[model samples]
Target chain A: METIKNLLMGFSVLLTPENMLYSFGGVLIGQIVGILPGLGSVIAIAVLLPFTYSLDPIPALVAFCGIYYGSQFGGAISSILINAPGTESAVMTTVDGYPMAKKGQAGRALGTAAISSFTGGMAGSILVVLLAGPLVQMIISFAAPEYLALMIFAMACITGMAEKSSQAKSIVAICTGLALGTIGLDVSFGAPRMTFGSLALYEGISFIILAIGVFAMAEVMRNVSNAKHNGLQRIHAMEVVGRVGISLKDWKLIIPTHIRCTLVGFFIGVLPGVGAATATPLCYSLEKKIIGEDNAEWGKGEIRGVAAPESANNSCAMGALMPLLTLGVPGSSSAAIMLTAFMILGIQPGPLLFQNHPDILWALLASFFIGNVMLLVINLPLVRYCVKLVQVPTELLFMSVWILAIVGSYAVGLRVFDVGMICILSVLGVVYGICKIPLAPMLVAILLGDMIEYYLAATIVLCRRSFVNFMSRPIVLLFLVLAVLVIVLPMLRDRFKKNKVQSAVDIIDAPE
Target chain B: MKSRQDLLFEIKVSVFLLVFALVYVILTLVGIDTSGRFLQGNAGLDPTTFPYFIGIVFTGTAFYLLVKSIYQYRLNTEKENTDAAKGIGIPVVEKKPFPFPVKASLVPYIAFIVYIATLRLFGFILDSVLLSIVILFYLNQKNRMRNIIFAIVFPVFVFLLFNKVLDVRLPIGYIFGAKY
Candidate 1:
């Protein structure tokens, strides 16, 4: 009854015209940004963050949340129409989505994607309302040691889940990010550590600059390089969207996949440090295995293939808000940026959040449902026009991204030094991109590294200078064990697989 | 099978990381301002302790990576030699250059830097317009009038959106006045 009343109150607050308009605008911009390759929600939110500073907290939160979910809807458009994933989470969509487009079922591919995204997002928002309250109460009992252990578990999971990169490389990237985080003034002691006598480095490298440099700018360099090599092949959208929408038969096939993937993605999101990137691949591989058919058309135009990953990633986006709002731990890179907004708005999201700001919290939760509906309405009808974005010349797109990145970086600090750093970081990003190094771990590390240090320091102080005392805490011990398993399980699994393959080859070679 | 180029790149990255870790370790040891004895009594909460530990761990990981890369390189080379002896050669794949002219693609990045460098002198409107025009020319967008219109219009749009609507302050161009 209490939860129902609170939810009703939240709905009343969110139904206001001003809040709805902001949500509309946010989703609109998010869709546009997500349609453009190299301009993900992380950079979009960062660019629009300053604009939210002067607005009322409720409307601002509503808009930002809209952008977060709306971008997921927009991401599917490019992935299906052009094979370019506007966000990392959308990467898996292109595998099956592009194949669907090639088969002239672009509308079906896009329609299913839209429907699945909405279902996943709605599921996530519902989970947030149900799970976040209890989770916050549970986490409030945690001490510094538990927090330290949780962070370690997060790092381990992320490193293990990294795509297309060796674990060693991922570790190197994360450690390097942590090292960079230590560059500015030491928070514990006001003395600067790695500034190297430069006053500009005193405040530390801005997260916004780093995000733009590696994610946005690096993407531009790669695209330019790709266009230079591939001669800029044009992406032509299908003239007809076959059937224009999903039929009942298609819905029956996808409903189960959506529920399963959403559950998987939501759980992963609740874990700090993991996000949609991890969840999407997990769902993709799981869906493949469960198909149980030798002739299963995965990586082809299988609707379930597109449906699974799209739903998972969208759910993952919603799931991420769980930790961010309740535990003050950002579940993904985009959420990390959102944490900055929460701080800027003088709202620290943790145990006290619900008690002190129940109205804000419930309203934010209610806005998620509104935002998801808005995204569906905007995306389903406009996908055809959105697909036309692929037809825009590659050169024009590159130039626009470059201009946005430069201005976005400048708007953060309004200093030439920030631009200089962007240039340097852009070059670095290009190098990293060329090397095929994973940047997600590094981005996560930068966001969590300081918190790790702070927690470690606090735990140490509480332990009276004896680190061994942490071993006595059961929760900490359990998490430490989980972290170790996360690291070692993949190695064991790989060795097991290799042995199995070798034995099969031996049998074939000897008997044949 | 791993290519020779991939192996070499791995080795190079490992070596670079090892050297970087070493530098980090040295700096943490010497540069941290402890204000007195590095370890006075309770070493747990010391500011330098965490960084020092990280530096050490980084060094160890980098060394491990270096050794692993070297081992993998040798294994790849040996496999290649064995394949040659068996009269089976791996197909040589040539490295492809960037599709667009490298210099052409770099033009926008260079223009962006120039715009930022000259922002104070030219102001936001002039600098943004000039930057947009330069980029449009590089991209080979043939409509000169359209380019000119966009170059002027985009900056004004941003100015009004940021300045008038959002109230976020933007550069007014030093040459236009003294207002920032």
Candidate 2:
């Protein structure tokens, strides 16, 4: 009853004209960014963050939530029309979506994507509301050790989940981010750690600056280099013919896929470091495996293939919000940027946020449902117009991104130094990219680094510097053990796979 | 086995990380100010403790990377030799050179720096407009008229949105000396 009342109040808070307008604007911008290739929600949010500096927390946060999921809707349009995914999460959509377009069933493919995305998002939002309350209540009593252990688990999961070849590089990236986070004045003491006498460094590198540099500027540089090498190709979107509606038969086929993918996407998304990028592919594969290859032609315009990943992609985005809102741990790179946004707005998300700022939390949750509906409305009727965005020139897009990145970084502090730092970090980002180091772990580490240090210090103090006492707490011990398992299991599996491959190769050579 | 280029790149990255970790350690030890009056024993942690720990861990990880890469390189070389000895030749893949030279990638970074340095003198609108034009031209030399129009219009739109509507103050060029 209380949850229902809270949700009702949330809807009331979100229904205001101004808030509605902000939500619409955010969704619209998100859709535009989503339709454009080489631009993602992360960059859009980071670029638009400074603009939100003047707005109230509820509207700003609501707008960001809109953008996060709105892009999922937009991503499908490009994938269906041009065979190019507007966002990384939409990559799987292209397999069946583009083929459907080629077969002149673009409208059907798009309608399925939009509807599935809506269902997934709505389902995920409901799950978040139900899960967030219990999760927060459970963790509210957690102490410093437990929090520290949780952070360690999250970090370990991120590092473990990295590509096998890039695991070591991921660790280096995380360490570098942690080191960078330690630059400012210590929270415990007023002593500056590594400022090196620069007053600007006293506050440490701004999260906004780092985000723009790493995500947006670095991406622009990479895209430019690729364009220079490959030369720019004009985009030609496939025509959307016929009505954009699904038949009852198609709905029957899609409904089951949506339910399964939504559940899978939500659960996977709840885990730290896994987001839609992982969930989409996993859901697609799971759907394929279940249906069997003989039954369904997956890559050749199968509606279930279109339905599965779209559902997972949107739901995973919502699921990623669970950790961010409940545990104050960002589940993905986009969530990490949102964490920074929360901090900038003077709101710290976690258990205490639920108690102190239930209004904001519930309202934000309510906006997701509203945003998902808004996305469906926009995606269904205007998809033809949205597909036109793919026709936008790459040069103009890159230039605009560069402009926004520069202005946004400078607007945060009105500091040229911040702008300069964006360039430096962007160069560093390019280097990290060249070396195959995952940037998501680094970004997450930067956000979590200070908290990790603070919690570690608190844990040490609480335990009286006794390792045994620290390990005595069941929650802390369990999480720490889990963290260890998370790190070790992947490595063992990789080694086993490598050994199996080697043995097979040896057998082949011996026989020959 | 990894290709020769991959091995060399790995070695280079490892060396860079090792050097960075070492420098971080040195800076943490020597640079941080710990003599503040708030430095009491009761405080849970001194400033350097966390950074020092990170530095050490980073150095150790980088060292591991260096050793691992060297070991992988040696294994790759041995594999190549063995293949050659068996009268099997490894295919050499020709790498395509990037259309732009290495230095060309640095152009945007340099332009950004110049834009920032000149922002105070040239003001927000003029500098932004100029920067936008330069970037558009560098990105696509064609569409000169359209790009120029967009370059001017977009920055002005951003300026109005930020300055007039959002109530945020953007930098005004000293040369313009114009009040909004």
Superposed by TM-score, candidate 1 places the C-alpha of residue A274 at a distance from the truth, in angstroms, of: 3.2
Q: Give the local distance difference test score of model 2.
A: 0.87
lDDT of each: 0.79, 0.87
Q: Which residue runs of candidate 1 sit more than 4 Å off their true CA positions?
A: A163-165, A224-233, A294-300, B26-31, B37-43, B96-106
User: Which ten residues in a row are the worst by lDDT in model 2 chain A?
Assistant: A224-233
The Cα error of candidate 2 at residue A285, in Å, is: 1.6
Q: Tens-digit lDDT track for model 1 on A64-100?
A: 8888888888888888887889777899999999999
User: DockQ (Cα-based) per candidate?
Assistant: 0.45, 0.59
Top model by TM-score, which number?
2
Pairs with steric clashes in candidate 2? B123-B173
List candidate 2 segments past 4 Å from native: A228-230, A499-512, B36-38, B96-101, B178-180
Please state the error at residue B44 of candidate 2 in Å.
6.2
